[model samples]
Target: MSTATLPRTRSRSRVQAPKNPRDYVRIGLWIALAIVMVIWAMPMVFVFLTSIKSEADIFSTSSFAIPGAPEWQNYAEALATGNLMTAGGNSLLIALVKVPVGLFIAAAAAFALSRIRFKYDTLILGAFALGSMVPIQVALGPLFKTILDMGLLNNPLGVILPYIGFGLPMQVFILHGFFTQVPKEIDESVRVDGGGNLRLFLQFILPLSKPALAALFILDFVATWNEYAIALVILQNKASQTVPLAIQSFQSQFTSSYGPLNAFTIMSILPVLIIYLLFQRYFVQGMFTGAVKG
Candidate 1:
């Protein structure tokens, strides 16, 4: 065979690695993102680690290191000692009752403000928005007195009623923005079909505003669940205390410990986290839609 015709094979294939400035920049960005993720995750990781550690280990060992044996009983002890089930039940009832009621009233008001075009519309909205700016602390004394006058102190209804009233401002504000973004043509079409405001709101408007409603409900649930000051003040009886108050009991004037408290905290956050995750897509969409449309 002729030398030129003979088959030639290379000993190795040359592979190129990233060498461009943009490629290096991409690599730098990935590294920075990873660092940020680690930083953000550390607190959550520490909480879980500390919750499963024995008190002795927690005090003797480094906060960053893992324990040899996880104290799963810490959760059980925390639950029993905190009376978490009762607190959790109270919180759940408040959320379930208040969320729907608040949403209905807010949605109706929002519909009137945005669609009906009644007199003093802007003035009404501004008044509600003003409530959002007023700190809860400012209202606590008056609210307490009102509850006392009404003979509702230490009652679940007291909390529920206040939650419904106080939660309305933000819910109305958000739903109004969402309701405004909805086309006017739809409302006119419904009216032309002989639909009244009630039918139109129930059949059309509420269905269209599910994302905003879910987002608002999730926010309300979390806020209501974690509320401490108002619950502490109003719920003088231990039986009516909510989860935040239960968590507070983990510390007393003479002694303070965080292991069992951390465990209860994790349990307390689970419901909120699960609900948020379930509705996360809608929540994100609702939030961004309100921002862009309004």
Candidate 2:
């Protein structure tokens, strides 16, 4: 009776080991990536280590080693003596006003270029695309002089306007690509319901384009936050200086406030880091959204 029936059990698959030189490439790549990551992170590690140490320990101990005790006062000293507070406020004001305003304008322009067919759509979009290639330095003098003549120099408007203007080209370019990828059927459907271009943009395009907007917003915010050359040129009033300018002036004036400088640098970067973390989920998605049309 036992010989008449048989039960089958599944055989386990054997694990394969690397058998040739090329088979070891994956391991080599992982090692190389780890090494590169360590190298990339070393500077930040050094800065953080230096920021926590007293000036004495900063110089006495290994640059990457932990401090005997954290010199937390360095942050306070930096905040007190440095123009960081004013500069930070100015930076915040500029970014807050500039990012949303700039993104809206860019998104509108992109919508017009991508969704609304016009006689010169290609020409206009190409012009903006080309503008992104022009060096900011090329316009620096003209921008400064225009701001000076308009009595806006050393004012928040000067920074905000230029930021919006310069930020537009790239933002529009990005949004245009994303906008084109959006189904024309949506626009046609909206128009069939008696919607105009404005309604189409606000109600349909914007809601669907949040990731693209977030990605662009984060990038533009970082650029505006850390802008040095333009802010240095336009924002001459120490009271109106931005973080980059404040850090520059701080370094030049103090010369030896290494710990405070490091602390200030840390503090300055936190906002951008936080913003990145908040929007990071959309970052890769938005960046590649326009890459292919499927």
Candidate 3:
């Protein structure tokens, strides 16, 4: 056979290679994932398109239509009118303070639960697991009264304290699961080296659990930043409001101003997007590793 004919034959054989069921399954998953992503992104796309349009254009045109004249000033108007910067700062402060402190507390609790054998350890872990399932709404009434009695209403601490409490169960559960996967030999070695539990936890376990901690930090920060119900109850004043409460107030104030409303909505989520992007590399790995056991 001619060399050209041999090349053609080889190409044909490659093209005609048999497909595996697994290959088909993988392709199907990719297609499904793409569809799911598009479905999820549609609303954000609509919001973004609306954000850039003139007020008149928003009502006159289709939801997804590009603005004929992009209204860049909408962002400026939103920022000034909505007081979103102040609210965002409040949210950021709460997140930065709450996430680290909550994580530290959770890590300590998780270490005790996973590493130390004590009476009622199983019961305590079970309680935390059950606590994770309890709705925040269930405790809202009593929580409000407690905050009120303490004169913490409209204070950041009111929100921060509750956020920490609500966050602990899930954080402890995730960290405990991850900590259990750490080899017992390391714990034994640390003990043999005359290291106390605090030293082992602070130096060894924490260093080893960076991925899980990063994942929890991102998740917790986002939750705290976006939380509204508890914040609404605790932070009644405009100055103390977080992003979600501020957005609600902004929407109320700008009932007819669609452009500014959409602009504010987009801006409110930017911090969360930044945070997720920063830790996304660790998110899936941490979730899977921690979830594997619990």
Candidate 4:
């Protein structure tokens, strides 16, 4: 009986705030980046999956399928059968010696080109630019002959010498761009302090150029480590073979053993990956800075 005069209540609806145009662009960029990352990572994921799978599992199941039981022995087999230890050691030594020596030579050349104005500087720089564009294949015959003549064939120096030669033009180009960005005042101040070119270069320029140097070091090291064509030509001796050559030999030797081959590949990639991860911060900065500054 008391329900005669009950009031009706209106329900309130929630209204959403309008999205900014920038929000959509940000979301689009993030989605694009995610897709790119997935695309890039797919091959690596498959390689890893294959590396741990049994030979039967690799062929029997889907490419992306997880293995029922991981064949951990694949790694051991790869290393032992490939003689990868000695190959890896040779690669490490080549990279260690080549990278620093190459960088120093490149830096010095860059310093000369960027600083001390001299006759034919532009012409010389043009020549280096020309040199960088020359394909390695074009020089292989002459390179091989020269190495043979020098008795450096089957020697690490054979590979090292060529690597340094090929690597220089690009390294010098990058370092020169970066070195030019250094203020003239710094060079003047160093000279005012009675510092010669060597002191200025060693004490000031090199320290200031660390980002560019680190970037070049990582790139040159990886390139040197993974180099195959030059290494194949120079390092004929099994004892002197680098990782890439050894991996090629391993593949040939173990044609049907996909598991161990994949494992060996993954192992070989680890050093370059580690080097990149260690110095990744400087890479982007150095590249963009060198590019944009000049």
Candidate 5:
């Protein structure tokens, strides 16, 4: 071959590593995530196994042991019980009645705070924020007395009304942030186009705030559904008790029998979980949307 045109002569080759180091960092993150997920999932798995076990197998088996054969009977027992069925019915009814009332009140309050300037706005907002953080234990005595005075003490409405009241402060706080993020021009433009406050709110504001609304509804539903302590206090009648109240009574039986209790416990969690999952996208989006709005 001609000297200049000959195939290039081989020289000692040196290998250079990939320039980006992020590959290793990403791999490490995935590994950490996997470990965390496994750790988190262990308890859920244990609960499922426990639900299937007969009362005899609960303590007899190793604490972390899985059931050899899953018995589906426990779910039937829990679901078939008169008290639980009543409780579930009561909870569903309360949530149905209470959610709209809660949302309406919370949204209206948030809209006022977000859009209108007033002398008491900041003060009232602060009050609501502070009230929302107060531990429920502080209000128990007066609340019980108030419920009794209303003659609704032992019914689901007793619990539902209180849920709305106690739930409002946080709901307003959340919604206020979301509302403040609303474009001011949208409000002014609506007014310019002959829309009043109610029209602007119902036609424009509420539609734009649907994500926040959905998120709030789902959260309130879950919180009200799973609330055991206050429900135990207000709902005295087993026949009219909410789900959490029923779950409490289930504990008494579970002290002697685990099968039905675990099953019922799992049953109680499902509705809340489903609510969360169903609204999860909107929930997460609303959280980010409001937080970043400033």
Candidate 6:
């Protein structure tokens, strides 16, 4: 072979590495995924690490360095320590008891807005929607003062009332859209079969809208559970404080202990995390179903 031809032959025979578009795309995707995973997981990892560190070690050690020994006692103390159990109980009451009431009222309003051609439907629904956009702090002071007048201050219902107010708008918006998408044939058939509005809503609409309602239920629960400002303003007695309040107890005016504080924060957030994971699919589907046109 000619010398130049020999060089060309070697180039043709050389088993080159993959440089195809698909292979390059896959590599880029994995690198992007790893970066994203690290970014998201970093906060959670820090919370967990702080939860397990002793106060002395937490103060002395570099924030980036992992603790030599994990302090499981912080979690125990948080659970068994002062006032936390009571605050946790209060949180449960507000989240569990108030969520159903909020859902029912909001769903009813949505149903009325979507299904009824009442004279005041537009006015009333718009009012509720408008209420959701105002910052909570804007109204909370006056709301609490009014609650005090009603003598419901330091009561579970006081916090619950505000929760319902704030939660209603988003709920109504989601549900009205969902109800609009329901086939009119179902309403006609129900009416033809001697069903009134009440029966129609109860038997058909409620069943059909369960997923949307479930999603709202979880959303409201988390909001109420984590709410601190309204709860602090309303609940004068520590006895009525909720989970966020309980977690706040970890920090003091003079000093905050990171180990116990982070531990308690982790403990407080764990239930919500668990609940979200368990019902994530339903939560996501309900939200999308409510938002999207059929």
Clashes of each: 0, 0, 0, 0, 0, 0
Q: In candidate 5, where is summed lDDT lowest over 10 consecutive residues?
A: 285-294
Each candidate structure's TM-score, on Cα atoms with residue i matched to residue i, is 0.85, 0.88, 0.90, 0.90, 0.86, 0.83
Per-residue lDDT of model 2, residues 21-106, tens digit only: 37478888999999999999999998888888897897788888888789999999989999988888999999999999999999
Sorted on lDDT, highest at the top, how do the candidates line up? 3, 4, 2, 1, 5, 6
The CA lDDT at 187 in model 4 is 84
Candidate 5 clash pair list: none
Alpha-carbon runs more than 4 Å astray in model 4: 1-22, 290-294
Q: How close is candidate 4 to the true structure, as a TM-score?
A: 0.90
Candidate 3 wrongly placed segments (more than 4 Å): 1-22, 290-294
Please state every model's RMSD to the true fold in angstroms.
9.2, 6.6, 8.0, 9.7, 6.6, 8.4
Q: How far does residue 30 in candidate 1 sit from its true spot (Å)?
A: 6.5
TM-score of 2: 0.88
Q: Could you tell me which residue pairs clash in candidate 6?
A: none
Which residues of candidate 2, in runs, are more than 4 Å off?
Answer: 1-33, 290-294
Q: Please give the lDDT score for candidate 6.
A: 0.82
Which has the higher lDDT value, candidate number 1 or candidate number 6?
1
Worst-scoring 10-residue span by lDDT in model 4: 285-294
Q: Which stretches of candidate 1 lie over 4 Å from their true place?
A: 1-36, 253-256, 290-294
| Candidate 6 Cα outliers beyond 4 Å, as residue runs | 1-37, 60-64, 253-256, 290-294
Residue 197 of model 6: what lDDT? Answer: 90
Per-residue C-alpha lDDT of model 5 across residues 1-294, encoded as one tens digit per residue: 655766888898889887964688889999999999999998887778888998778879976677788778999987876377778888888888898899999999998898889899999999999989988888889999999999987777788888888899999988888787788999889888998888978899999998889888887888777777778778777777888777777787666667777788888777778778888998887766755535
**Residue 23 local lDDT, model 1:** 73
